[model samples]
Target: MHFVVCLKQVPDTSEVRIDPITNTLMREGVPSIINPYDAHGLEEAIRLKEKVGGKVTIVSMGPPQAKEALKKAMTFGADRAILLSDRAFGGSDSLATAYILSSAIQKIQETDPIDLVFAGKEAIDGDTAQTGPGIAQRLDFPQLTYAIKIQELTETTVTVERKTESGRQIVQAQLPALITVEKELNDLRYASLPNMMKAAAYEPEVWDVKSLSFDTKKMGLKGSPTSVSRIFAPPGRSGGEIMDGTKDPAATVATVVQKLFQQNIIMVNPLAKGGKS
Candidate 1:
């Protein structure tokens, strides 16, 4: 089995700032780390590799600095790392990102057949949660999202427990499926000394636009259909009125109810009766 995990380097959300003029994230002088959800996805991929005896490869699309995120993933026991970086890929929305990633994955499959693809349910910065499914659509692979646990897996099929708003669902899909995982899927492992040393010295293979064949119209800002218009903090909430009922408790209750009714916060039932028989 050969698995590929998609990872991303994102600015630490706690310290992130927005450019008021451009309405984009201010990445300069901010610390970057492997996306937390992607880290969990990487952990699950490594665990599967350990159980099934296969190789895990990590792929990322970013600038040269994003190689740091790939190296970090390597410390978790991925066999290889690939970085898709090029000027043409700048300002790519989720759609363009998915296209670029799909192209890179197709290239990887030329030599090694991929059995499974792993990705986080959403990138923290964007939170659109569309890239994984987009890649699956492009590759014609079965897509599973919000997977919380893996129930079983074989050479031909894989069973998973997926989280949904209504409840949990047990789903099974054939091989060569793409799974976008929830952070609840797995906990990250501490890398061994040897793996850490290897990661520290590893240099990921970088593939630019010239290295991959992709449509020029389906990349970068030109391919992005959505753009942020403006960003501003919400107005601060004001303090609410306090009702003191220490003296006239019953009268105060009646007054509060009357105020609520006047404000339309509570509706009155004219025909309803409330009494003990």
Candidate 2:
């Protein structure tokens, strides 16, 4: 299994700042980490590689600094890593991100055919959960989002359980499928001394638009379709007064319940229809 995991370097949630003028994330100075959900996917890939004996390649699209995330992934025993960095790809939306990542995957496939592509449910920075599906759509591969378990796999097919608001759903797709993983999948393992040493010395292969044989017009900002206009934090609510009910707990509780009843906050209906007649 030549598992390809798509990782993203996202702004640390606590450090996220948006530019009011451009609606762009203030990434220049913000600390970054591998997308949390992608971390789970990487762990799964590593586990699978251990079982089946194949290579796991980590791929990411971001600025030069993102190589740090790739190196972190390499510490977990990924066979190789690639960073797709170019000025033209700056300010890309989900569609453009998926396009760029898809191009990178295609390039990797040329060297060794990719059996599967794993991604996170969403990035904390974007929270769009659109890039994974977008890549699958662009590559014409089957997409299984919110996957919680890999039920089974074969040379030709893969079965998984996807989590939904209603319940868990079982889905089966072909081998070259794309999966957006959930945090429930697996916990990440600590890197051993050898793996850490390997990662410390390994420089991820950097691929620019030219390296991918991509036309500059179709690979960067020119290829992107969406743009952010402005960004700002939402207004906060003012504090409310707290009620005093220490004198008589039951009396105060009854009084509060009565007030809620009068306000129609909670109602008892003798005639409302779902009665077990």
lDDT of 2 by residue, 29-136 (tens): 778898999999999999989988789999899999899999988999999999999888887789888888998898778889988899999998878999999999
Off by more than 4 A, model 1:
239-256, 269-277
Each model's TM-score? Answer: 0.92, 0.87
Top candidate (lDDT): 1
lDDT of 2 at 77: 91
Q: How well does candidate 2 match the true structure in TM-score terms? A: 0.87
Q: List the residue pairs that clash in candidate 2.
A: none
Error of model 1, residue 232, in angstroms: 2.7
Residue 1 of model 2 has an lDDT of 88
